[model samples]
Target chain A: MKSILTEQQLEITIKRLAHQVLENHVDLTNTVLIGLQPRGVFLSDQLVDEIKKETSTEKIQYGKLDITFYRDDIRKELHIANRTDIPFSIEGKNVVLIDDVLYTGRTIRAALDALLDFGRPEKVELCVLIDRRFSRQLPIHPDYTGKSIDAIVSQKVKVFWKNRDGKDEVCLVND
Target chain B: MSLSTRHLLGIKDLTVDDISLILETAEQFKEVLQRPVKKVPSLRDVTIVNLFYENSTRTRFSFELAEKRLSADTINFAVSGSSAAKGETLLDTVRNILSMKVDMVVMRHSASGAPHFLAQHIPAAIINAGDGVNEHPTQGLLDAFSMRKKLGKLEGLKVAIIGDIMHSRVAMSNIYLLNKMGAKVTVCGPPTLIPKYIRESFGVEVNYNLKETLEWCDVANVLRIQLERQNQVLFSSLREYNIAYGVKRKLLDNLNKEIVVMHPGPINRGVELDSDVADSKQSIILQQVENGVAVRMAVLYLLSGRNPGNN
Candidate 1:
């Protein structure tokens, strides 16, 4: 029902996440970034840009990944497919799986299955802009977290990117 | 919409949303097909039997590829002039096969409603590959999926299905599915090949003249003449049928509008379509073949409650 993150806060959180990624993994050769499909694509693109600017690294290796078919809730209803454009090989590379809002951790779990079809990675990690508190159905946790939201079960966490929705902000909606 | 149908007996049994869901799922699976390692470990424990009563090289091969891609252990049950012709009933044969603990049956029988009949008696999933003159649901699904991919949408698109309607499970299924998708489907062919009371029953228009049908439609689905199924009652000769219904490049170009040409293949190239037209830019015949693999995968995947081991 209210805006938890304004434009300035979203921009600041993105810069902080970029610094954290660089501080953790300095040598970015084998490190590959994959954005979960749909909204995560926008956030991942911004984060990739921030990392590149902060570290002076060209071609940080990022792509979109869709896990629609691998989802456990596939039979519950239909999910529209998003474009996946991972041109580089992820085999033996450090894979960074990124998403906007991490609610149940199920989407990331499905992404893990989808990533294996490409090839086996040396290591796989998760990154999310909004970590919805106390809402994970799986034991999966993000390696890099941007802004954690203390939201209840009935409310939803939504992230809007300036490139996409003409503003950068996060809001909690009553379902 | 979620898929809940126990059997894919026909397009007549599928709702429009069901058709949409299948196409959407096929879209994702199509991407999977393009991957280097195309096989997935989704249907690992599931045993699917490709029980083909009739011989169709493309359909059988496509279904086999789909089954393998999903990691389902598939057994090809091809009945020749042996047991099926030696007076063994279809029900008995299917039951005997099911006794082997098969999880699903993809059957292509010569008799209409054979799969439907099997679905009634069997506990396994029944996928009607093609049941004589009744339906080839997967073929129909892929055709619509291809059309929507090429044309951007299906609703209100004028689709003319030319040649051999009465004998084609493809034509019947296409009519049922396309009409449900809000596409205006006109059955065009020699009057003898078209079943009577289709207009009265299915409420679809019938066109006898090929040129008129070509000019009035956005896409023309040219069906191969089922020469094996025809007799003296239908038409005089193949040459006469070719002259009347065969789609040539000249006829398509003269329409002055881009009309997509589609054929459920094993194409009698010079009979239903000219060899040039079959390989023409406007023809999506190859796309139909490629899409058939994905559509069948979507069907098998959804039928088993999303078979690829859900994470």
Candidate 2:
């Protein structure tokens, strides 16, 4: 196992990602943040907290989306669904789709399909804590990334959250 | 997680975990139903067939809507106009349909254990819509879903299954499910309508008094009088039965506390459930119909997830 980002580094990277999101959106009046369900929620939750702390505002439009129903590979295996609580409308607003890791890009593909069902957004952006470069199966690229790493297909990149995993770190594990 | 059994022949065959998983999955589908699109691509690649050897309205349409909402291709078969009327056997009918590459079968038959019989011979996963007076597993599931959604829990909840228990597949399924989920159940109706060994066999309370039953339960699942299924005169007449056992507004109003009212529908208003009580705020009859679609969707989706080769 190779450690990519330690606990302190993960905190700094999250703060940097929050600032980058705020810099792009300015006041975030027409923007919304959506965390992908199951694993991606940890990153998005912390990112939203950091954004709130920086802006000194608790009115950030945020929600969670579960894309299990929109996956193209559903026939291959069964996936249990999670709660989807996108309470606010995303119509004509800039939406940021957040997740923990980006690889193969199939999840992002399914997420995009799931998002269009809510309402047509003005634009959709991708934000991730770790981006596994050179391994995407689709043309999806992240607008804000905490770290970019190059790994082979067999290697797995996992992001550990303090709230769930008892630590905040990113690691590359070889089988 | 996946269901323990591939075929939903009856609620008697399900574990509490299976019931909970299905209801939990149904909760997700219920949210999907509230969305703008109200459809999903989870079962787009699968095809299902609804074989109704018996007549139906809610179960048939609920299963059809559930299949369509999941983007599944469905074929509806009614015994009246089908080859069955031309003296075809059940096995031959299903075999012919299987040749069309169908993945699942939702069947309602007048013969008990019909779906179980089909499951033994067919490669397709079978969901028993209602088999004789045996079990309507989906209706049982939706009832539990509606109860939990309203009362917020199932364990230790007092539920009374009122009216025609001897001929009610819904009651059988509900009793099996409620017992497995740790809920308290009582079969309430006329003495001749409820089965004799029900109290001993299913470990449920049996009541002959309608008003007493209503006051002692948290939810009352009143069933329609299956007059067609009854060969002998179980009661003097419809009016006599209504006066003795019908869930009238006057009786419900006399209860010390409000209790949820549910019916498996096609309600014989004034005979089993009065129209005023059926339309009352405490009645989740319409929400039961709405949840029926989601519950059936969960069943179909989960059963379809099993290995296709095995199914």
Candidate 3:
């Protein structure tokens, strides 16, 4: 396993992404944050916390979306459902869809499908902690990328959260 | 992954993994119910026919709605209006339906094992909606799903199923399913309502006393006494049943533990359970209704195979 981002590197990358988001949306008035289920949700929680610490933004609309049903590979295998506590509506909101890593862009595509079921958002942007280059099956691209990596076809990128995994790091391992 | 059988005939036929698979798939679709646009284009090319020989409007409608949400074209067979009313056999009616290229048949018949018979004869997938005191597999699944959701796990959880044990498909299916999921089950009611072989055949304990049964269980799925199904005197009177078997506040408090109250509804409120207990915090009766759609969707989604048109 090749370590990509250490604890300090992860912190710096997250802070940079948070600053970039704040710079783009000053008030975040119509902007709501949604994270893909399970793994992506950790990044969302950290991002929201970092954003709140840096800025005086209160009442930030944050939700966790489960894209299990919308996934293309659902029929191919079994997928356990995750928590989907998106209470507020994303209708007419500038939605920021967050995930830990962008690999084949299939998960983002599924998230997009799941999001459209909620409501027609004004605009939807993708944000990721790591973006794998030239490995996308779809034309989707992340608007806010933290650390872009060029991993081989047979390699897998695994993101480990500090709270859940007892460390904050990213690894690229050969399959 | 596909189920071992093409048709879901009964809970007796499902393994614990099969039960878990259906519940997990149902949970995935539960999010769809919360969405504003409650339609998914998953089964656009497939067609399902709801063939009900008996009047189960509630269960039938739930399956129909689930099919619609999955974008599957549905043909709600009016069994009474069709040639089946003119004394057509179940086999002939379904054969005619299958000739129309129907991909799946969700059947609710008055006779036991009607879906099983159709399943053997027909090529299309068969889901036993309700088969005359035999099994309502989806209802059993939804109840177990709700149980797992509330109690966190199914294994080693004690569940007490009370009232109308003799004629309830719900009771039989729940007993088979909860047992398969490694939960202890007790069927309690009048001596006449409790079948003798249920204890010996299934190994689920039989209880005649309500208070003792409530004390023993972590969950009590109080079932509606089907008056329509009752042709003989099973009990002395409704008041006696209420007094002896009905789940109310006093009996619930005797348990002194968090016991979930559940019902397969169209409830005989005062007969099987009181209003206070039915509407209480311990009850997950309403959540069962919401889960019915999701469970049915999962059953449909998994059994129908991947939609070739989805890609």
List iRMS for all predictions: 4.1, 1.9, 3.4
Error of 2 at A57 (Å): 3.5
Where does candidate 3 clash, by residue pair?
none
lDDT of model number 3: 0.88
TM-score of each: 0.85, 0.98, 0.85
**Rank by TM-score (best first):** 2, 3, 1
How do all the candidates rank in terms of DockQ, highest first?
2, 3, 1
Q: Give the docking tier of candidate 2.
A: medium
Task: Give lDDT tens digits, candidate 3, residues A117-171.
Answer: 8899999999999999999999999999999999889999999997888999999
| Residue-by-residue lDDT tens digits, candidate 1, B1-311 | 46758678899999888898889889878888887678666677678889888998999999999999988899987787458778899889888887887888999988998888888887888899999888999999999999999999999999999999989999989999998999999999999888899999997999899999999999999999998887666887778778888999889888889999999998997888999999989999999999999999989887863433321
Across A12-66, the per-residue lDDT of candidate 2 in tens digits comes to 9999999999999987889999999989899999999999997757568999999
Q: What is the C-alpha RMSD of each candidate to the true structure, in Å?
A: 4.1, 1.2, 3.6
TM-score of model 1 (CA atoms): 0.85
Q: Candidate 1 at A140: error in angstroms?
A: 5.8
Off by over 4 Å in 2: A56-58, B308-311
Model 2 chain B is weakest, by summed lDDT over 10 consecutive residues, at B302-311
- Which 10 consecutive residues of model 1 chain A have the lowest summed lDDT? A73-82
Q: Please tell me which predicted candidate would have the highest TM-score against the true structure.
A: 2
Off by over 4 Å in 1: A1-11, A22-32, A38-61, A71-83, A87-94, A100-110, A119-123, A130-141, A147-175, B81-86, B305-311
